[model samples]
Target: VALNQQPRDMIDLHARMFKKHGITTIRNFDALNDLRNLSYSGERIAEAGLHHQIVITIMDLPPGCEGAHTQEDYSKMLKDILDSDIPFHSVCFKDSSGTVHPRKVYETIQAARKMVPEDMILHLHTHDTAGIGISQYLAAIEAGITRIDLAMSPVSGGTAQPDILSMWHAMKGTDYTLDIDPLKYIKVEEVFEEAMGDYFIPPESRMVSPLIPFSPMPGGALTANTMMMRDTGTLHLYPKVIKEMEEVIRVGGFGTSVTPVSQFYFQQAYLNATQGRWEKINPQYGNMVLGYFGRTPAKPDPEIVKLASEQLDKPVFNEDPLDILEDGRPAAEKKLQENGLAVNDENVFIASSCESKGIDFLLGKAKENIRRKSTEAAKAEKIVAPTTVASADSVMGLREYTITVEGKAYQVQVAEGGGNPIVSTPVPAQKASAPAVAVKVVEAPTPGNILRLEVKAGDQVIANQTLLVMEAMKMESEVKAPAAGTVVDLHVSDGDTVQAGTPLLSLSS
Candidate 1:
């Protein structure tokens, strides 16, 4: 989905690149467990002389939510993989969310072992976000899983794969063995920590979240969502949004909570929380439920399907998603040529996937964004009240001035006769009051960064016409006019961050 060119071009490019980098194996899986989505890619990888590890995503749906991620669901996927005759050397039971129950993991792996050839490698990959990764891995090992993903400390143990040392320790005296040196791993951890000392590690990434099994968010997506919320000053809404995810997953057809799908669930949950429940449906969420991605494990709720159909203005589609997407190479090359860039495969792919930013990179217009720790400390400021204040010296009995320190500006306000500023009503200028006009102030429905303004001041718009676009939780939302009016004032501009109910613009009928 990140690539621009045709699927054929994208698959070929990636397969060749992975081989060039000495990668011998590629684990490929689709979020919806659609074999159709993985078939071509698997073939390409095998044709490229790389081992293809076809994957079936695994997760336990939030308790009381059902119809998918069952033993039958996994067996059906395995059967599909085998029946498709797609080239593969291994199979992976991957749970990015770390929400799979231990018994279910054991049963699935044991069952998979019996189905695949004896030589085929069976791998298990999961995170420790819910603090059950190690237990799940143990279950897999007992069920004859040959290989499992592991990480080292500092980066491990929280939202990452189970730490190698911890797993090694857990297997002590058991028939199974990790067979690695602890001293070497300690040194590795020390060096890794030193190398990463300058960067700020988000606290959420470092701590295990007990809520993962409940909401079932993947580790990578959880950190990403949290960081975006932190940047937009909406971190406080995270818990409420997470709580809202239960209903989204329960009703939205339980596709495995992995990327694209995971992000869709998260974005929808956020909207449901900030906006009224089901007030606004995320486009991707709407599309997924409408079967645009592929068949979800079970049928989605009919009410949600209807809501999505109406909101997205698209009918339900059940065909393979890959067959629906138009070939993008011709358009990509045309765009590259229009921009006077060489229409090579590399340029075409870049333009196709990266969109404008890719074009900017080709044209040398891309700006570098690098974050580094600041070395200089900010200096403190001391504020002192005036010894004697005159009533006429201040504007409306209040004083305002800006102070600059270390290249940063700080606005300061001083009140006259300030032991504590006394409340006083300001006198109005000696002028007649203006006539009252019917004006409507349009406020933001949720916190987001303003993407663009569709209607500027004095622009006449009809009711329900889009007035501005907002980016929230990595999704673009159109803010429409509530009624017909002329936009009289804009309180915000493009790229300004706004909170829920913050005034965005004013309209006069």
Candidate 2:
């Protein structure tokens, strides 16, 4: 629906292609917001003779209601789908934020089982964001949910799904028993733990966070936003951003804070905190308010809608937004050809669906430029033989002395026969002087790969303008200008690895 150009034929093609690849099932969520699109996709999946599972993500917070419908509303929506002859194979309750209480899970599932057909399968998918996902799954199972999703120990917990081993242990000697070897899973856990190494987030840190119920930011977005704020030296303002997020969700109409919706809320909150409330609204948020994305779960505040409409200079679109888009396949093919790329149906489709630069990099048409410098020290070894050989008539004695210079030790040997003293060469030290003009060196704030350069040598820039973007610890950080100046030198290129305090560029007034 975001693309707005392709019709149901695209869905048909996708389903058939997946079926050709030996895929038998497809799962989806967020159908209420895009019921028309999802229903169309479901029809195509049914036509392709594949099983389709539609997941209803459940959240219980009052503030979260702005972004999602209530459990009863979700049940009604599910009934509508079941009655539509859409050939859905199952219905699932997904707790992406892991914020649903255990009791609520049991009650929600119990209610859903009554609404769903007895023959249809019921599944539960959840995360461990708040560290209660395993209990939630247990509740869901007791409520007649047959399928539950879990992850291995090393990859599970924290922001990820619950551990399969934990579930196995919990279900032991119960009616909901799992038939699996615990020892085999233990081996798998060991292998993955060793493989993940430094990337692993210890289980202890994945414990329940008290702030999640109030903030409701997904794990990935929260970490990314925190890193971004820290990199920009605005971490102190993060609390304000979180407060603004609640306001944004309320005024912007409650869209589920996941994926594109989550991103919209996060961006709007940042803007609201930094640029004043509603001073600058993102075009996507404006469109969302205008009903361009789809019918929001709740109507946006009239004042907010009016403000967005005035900014966009267009009224809210009640009809499907797909009606306004023109087919972009031809243009996509032309663009690929212009770039000297071989255009195929799939390639053109993908190119049209995503940003060109990102697609080019993913396709390896653009290469990453990185330079490696060795920092190893050179070592020299020397051997000296006696200057005079001992004879039968006379014996020569030698003495060895150790001398230290600049903390480095050296060994010297001398003959007792008054041989010239073994003397070492002395080098004069150079004096340091201050430069006439101070050069402002911009250094990296963290170790990361330079993702892109926003400025070049001789480019004039103002204070706080982003000079580059870097990726570190799986988050993108912007390197901004410290003061207004002309870029005198660039020491790193895109994809260069840099450490904290590594000089990246130089600027002069």
Candidate 3:
């Protein structure tokens, strides 16, 4: 949607590439549980001779919100996919948020087993975010699921798929058994740990979040959002953003808390906290509520629907999403030709799917900044102690102090004779000064990293025109010109981090 890419061409290109790369199976799913969205993709996957595992997304709605996301709702979804023209070799019950109860997992799979063919496979995938991975998996196995997704240690627990060893141990003393060695997984983990030792793992990615059920954030997206917040110096807003999501989900048609939709909820919640309640509706969220993404399981709240229609300046859409998008292959090829890049199937798909970054890459302007152990150590070594000497006449006994630099706090003890002290001069007091001039400046609405500056010095801008784009809590917001004026000076550049009320640019009326 960001690139306005056509679904048919993108899906066909990806399916052929997967088959060429020796991938035998692909798990296909839509976050909204819209079968119409998956029908064409599944057909293309089969055309490429790949086993397609059609997914039925599942999640538990927040307390006091109902009529959707229940087991019955999922069963109906399963029946729809079976009843549709989509071809698949297996069915997966996917709970991205890891909030579904064990009973629900068993019941959903049990109901699915009855509807699904005996020869076709039934798969289950979930995370351990809420400490329910084992129970949920066990329930699915008891319900006769054929396969479950597992991961190794370090990347295995807390905001990731459940660990192989944990499930292996859990299955012992039961009729079900895993065909694997626990010690082998231990050896594999050792290698993985050494390989990833330099990468900084956010603390939230390593612990169970008790509030997950209430917030219903996906494990896959949890750490990614936190890492971005950390970079923007807005990590403190994480809790507020998560808390605001409860209401976003309550009225967001209860689509399963998975990708695209999950991101929409998070983006909306973050905007509500940083940009005021519903003051800035995330375009993706607005599109979803307006029925651009396909029919949500339930109708979205009427008020929110109206708000989205007004803010996005789009009428409520009721047609299939794929029907509205134009064929993107020709546009992508034209973009490549315009940039003097070769147009091939791969290039067209990349340009269509990746947007501007893909164009930069094709032009050989993309920079590689992969993190390594030595780079991390270099960053730590860059922190230095204060070098400026305190004035001798300023204070007689100020020896201890606490200071924070670059997000790290330190305690320092100043000695009496470290460096040469400058002499102090006293000036006579002056009369009351006149009030300072009231300068007009555009300021950041919240602490965030500047994505780009839309205006330069001496550029004329109209009121409400975007001056820059800022990303805070993983949501992007435009910093608009407060009034029509000529841009006098810019205080920040691309990728600069700023706090709330920091002047982004000065404008002269």
Candidate 4:
């Protein structure tokens, strides 16, 4: 379950619902850092008579010091919960980023097994992002971890959990065996592969990337960033962005690149590349630097911290960051009531936890708007041919007439025996080409939809100035002027589909 993304109240509500459905065990990923907030959640789960487990996400970066520091932190967090009368079933070492080396995984699991009680189960969860998930799992198993998380094929590799079939085969001759049939899983894989044929499935999502260990972008974030870049027509810059991310992660103290931290790193790196270095800092990054998200494995660069602090006025809270946030349920309930929506625990939870647009979609507001727009577009495109009235005379045999229909002149000839009428083809007028001049034609670098037009004809633009924005592969890219000149023509408009090398605009110096 997602602990970092939502509040304790929401989690409690979710736990109650899950318990109603007879779900006895719930594992919370990314749990160690949010202990204070999770304390109430744990109480609720225990109160509901449910088994709870917390997964401490680990990264083996920054080498020796961070591993030890994180292990200590995890030990303290586990001890705190166990001492608090909260009954937890197990603990997990989650290498969600797949950054942990196999040896490190073994060492960490070995240390953790000794630290926890003998009865307490140890679980291992790792992704195949760096293609070392199977090895890591093996290491964890050797270190006494019994429970391991694995996914089926199609959804099983790259950023996702390791493939269960692969692991099962590897363990076929071993004492630690899985009860399963390979054929059943292969059938499921085939169904998913067929179903996802139309969707954008990144190569990294299903294949090994040698660059992942160096880049260290989490699987989820990598997919998201790729789509974002594709939508912006800036997918070509992805490699550069990944390289920039390496430095960002390093300077930002190499915090486990997951969720809130991963997003922070991604946004900062994206802004650094697209705008300027540290020119646009996300507020969360500033909060992180100020110690709002708890302590980093390594301290952030003092220079970065100072710079971000100055920009954000350096608001630092010594205690848990959640202490500063006012409970949002009351406000959410009030807003729902004001909108004539039923003010219940579920609605309030959704309102408080979800974005306004998301709530509107859930309420069918967005869906209704889409249906209305579709209806309008359908009506606009409906073809309506002009109605014509004709009469034929046998004595005249045939007659020819010029008729005006729908403001267009049409020549029609009536012949004997209702023969088909022959119509003249209209010739479109063509204009002479402009005199040869030194002009620059800016073409689209990739296939995408024109998101916005920044300039129009007769407008003066400077070299490197953004001429327009295009979205491709789920990313946005800025189309810039090739040379300083007066805009002569625009070949594309907002929302127009374009192809690579398609002329977007023209300028004459």
- Compared to the true structure, candidate 2 yields what TM-score? 0.68
- Number of clashes found in candidate 4: 16
Residue 375, candidate 2: how far off, in angstroms?
A: 15
Give candidate 2's error at residue 318 in angstroms. Answer: 0.8
The digit string of per-residue lDDT tens for model 4 on 1-509 reads: 23124555666777787797789987765412546655666677777878888667677553323333355665665666667665567887767678788887887788788878888899987788888998888888888897998987667878898888898877765668778888898898899877755555666578776676776767777776665554445678777767677767777766777765776776677667766787756556677777776666567788888888887676655576555556666777776877678877667666665535335645766322122322433433211111121221111245556566666555566676777866743322354434656667676654456766889989999988989976543334577876799887776676676645566777888
Candidate 1: worst-modelled 10 consecutive residues by lDDT: 379-388
Considering TM-score, where higher is better, how would the candidates rank from best to worst?
3, 1, 2, 4
Query: Which window of 10 residues has the lowest lDDT sum in candidate 3?
Result: 380-389
Clash number for every model? 2, 2, 0, 16
Q: How well is each residue in 249-354 modelled by candidate 1, as lDDT tens digits?
A: 9899899998778888988898889878999887778989999888888889999999999987899998877776776688788889888999876777777766
Top-lDDT candidate index: 1
In candidate 4, how many Å is residue 489 off? 25
lDDT of each: 0.80, 0.67, 0.79, 0.67
Tell me the TM-score of each prediction against the true structure: 0.77, 0.68, 0.79, 0.68
**What tens-digit string does per-residue lDDT give for candidate 2 at 117-213?**
7877999887777778888988888898978988886667777788889989888767887778989999999998877664524333365665555
lDDT digits (tens) for residues 210-323 of candidate 3: 889999999877876776666555789999999998999988888888876887888788889877898877777898999998989889999999999998789999988998
